[model samples]
Target: MAQLSADADAFGPMLTIEQAAERAAEHITAVAGSETVPLAAADGRVLAADIVAPVDLPPFANSAVDGYAVRFADLAAAGETRLLLSGRVAAGADAADVTTENRAVRVFTGAPMPAGADTVFMQEDVGLDAGAVILPAGLKRGANARPAGEDLPRGDTALAAGRRLRPQDLALLAALGLTKVAVRRRVRVAIFSTGDELNEPGTALPPAGIYDANRSLLRALVTHAGAEVVDLGILKDERESLVRRLREAAADCDLILTSGGVSTGEEDHVKAAVERAGELAFWRVAIKPGRPVAMGLVAGTPFIGLPGNPVAVFVTFAFVARTVIALLSGTQPVRLPGLPVRLGFAYKKKAGRREYVRVSLAPGPDGIAVARKHPRDGAGVLTSLTETDGLVELSDELTSVAEGTIAPFLAYEMLTG
Candidate 1:
């Protein structure tokens, strides 16, 4: 599991969102070294080693069309170069008879080019007689012929280790006749939420109770990140059960995440249970909606204690969770593409802490751009984040920005799957 050692210092004071994120990335323990998994099951899985080309791609010079392969020098004349067609070669057919001097060969797409042939002329561009295929005038000297080793040479590293396998990667491996490949095992993450007052959706709320959306939302984010999410179900405010469930989940999960009982004053038992079972490190973030996000470990499993507030939970998952997972997987964490756009409205930042202002995007004079400030309030509000295009990254260094000042926008699309 990926939890930090007790040697890591706990959060001391109020931390800026960036500082909290950096701390989580540094302190969380990794889920051990990577191990190889089958290629059939490796899609979206992180790679464990570099894939070197076992053989030269295409293996040999091949035809890229169904036509005639001919010598370039032999086709210098304006009229057709009536060279004898030594033999026909379709894909999968090995050349039985090589094209002799100044001769041509009838070749199909993907077929290995014959000796003495420098180019291919499409069949439609050439005329065929009893035993010879006539080439058209001006047929280029080297047309439609893919040279051997043009794509890759043997012993070359075609794909770097730690590279995520995309569809194209799979296709390339298939072309190389590889049935299976080694990939990093998927990190298993366990997720849930806490609060005796919380109920799953579809259940009638008994007054003060709220819907348990954190577990589902967090589960989706973890799975979409190429992890195996073990749903531990929702836990109540009891410390013993919380500790028991955490111990159970830690047996097989690399990380454990919950959405409540993190703040120092919370009577809820998640924080207490973490301290009892393993470690509890809290970071009081300085951001608006995500300030209460927490981090720690439970029974050796890296623990992510997001605030019960929906918006805060999602925001913290994006900034902090992604960083920790990327570090564990040895994958480079992807920073959201922050595009500079003029704020349609004015916004003030908390003097010493960076803030994320949700904003809707619109087409500006140049191209796609974003507007400023939506509901800058409670973490429970999800509508603003959903309605807006992204978050406006208001740096702590800047106390305020005018209506027309350009500010960097981080799209919500970049945060979630």
Candidate 2:
């Protein structure tokens, strides 16, 4: 791991969320290398190159329904027209042997259209008279017929580079006859928490010790962001131990992430430990619940320190670490857009800092969804997250919001996804 240059001091003491995000994007310029993988294993991996179609989708004109294929010009304009039954075409069968001039060909769905037949009457929409097929009038030409390349044309780019492949993307690649694709390697994240009062779960608690929750929270979040997590457990609030762990993690991980010990408290050794090992910058972001966040490099690996509070850990990670992960993983960093919903409760906040209020939704009399704020505002309230549907994001300039006002709401699914 080589340290990337991040002049964090240039931004001053406090940074807006947008400024911090931009700084991360500018400083973290390196991406993981790519590898070729089979299509079955490509899901959730970011694409390293564009996928171009070698052949047109469908490859040929085909019937969209089980019906009678006919020449539109041979049908009478105002009444039903009967045509001699000449041939039949089933799916996967060639249409070269069928002669279809003024005659009808029985075609099943996905069957290649017979030469000179430009229209199809669905089997349910026609009748049979003796050995002839009768089609109703007013059916337009090319009805129920799929033209070649209608979906994707040959030589066109089907999937672009930097896109995270989904299950549907695999189906498209398979349709393009691709057995393997080039994808960026998964990012390796080294995660740990620092605090003397923290204890592992499933163990008897000491007098005033609390269970460690941030590591498990971060592991799931890092994995969901398409990275591999190297859990380092909890580091005690000691300068030497913190420095040692930081150095060790930097040797093998792409990013070193930790929770707590980055604030101004005396036990906050992460900032000093990082400075001792490499470089660090404390970014006091103008956001509620997560103001004391830190970013830097440890022995050349990128480092981010989240706040101690569980809610703060989640918020900071969603906005800050998520971007770093995207950059390191070679994927496009897309900010999930907030959905607009009406506020059911009034709220007040300062003008300079952004706020994320936990809220639950209910349908109002006007048919619009209403967002009600949670009763607790403490950062340490873990139930505030589990009990709310999402967060109502109040912008930095917003001073107050009245009942019935429309506000931007970010659902948990959107944040985690």
List lDDT for all candidates, in order: 0.77, 0.89
Task: Report how far off residue 22 is in candidate 2 (Å).
Answer: 1.1
Residue pairs whose backbone atoms clash in candidate 2: none
Per-residue C-alpha lDDT of model 2 across residues 1-417, encoded as one tens digit per residue:
535555667867887888878877776855658999999999888999999999999899999999999999899988989999998999999999798999999999999999999999999999999989988998999999999998899999999998989899999999989999999989999999999899999999999999999998999999889899999999999999889889999998899999998888888999889888988754588888799898888877899999999999998888888888988887767787888899989999998888899999998888878998899979999999999999999999999989989999999877776
Task: State which candidate has the highest lDDT.
Answer: 2
Candidate 1 wrong stretches, greater than 4 Å: 1-29, 32-40, 64-69, 72-100, 103-109, 119-144, 266-269, 286-288, 339-342, 372-378, 404-407
Please, what are the lDDT tens digits per residue for candidate 1 over residues 108-135? Answer: 9999888778789988888778777777
Off by over 4 Å in 2: 1-6, 77-79
RMSD values for the candidates in order, in angstroms, are 4.0, 1.9
Candidate 2 lDDT score at position 229: 95
* CA error at residue 361 for candidate 2, angstroms: 1.9
* TM-score (C-alpha) between model 1 and the true structure: 0.81
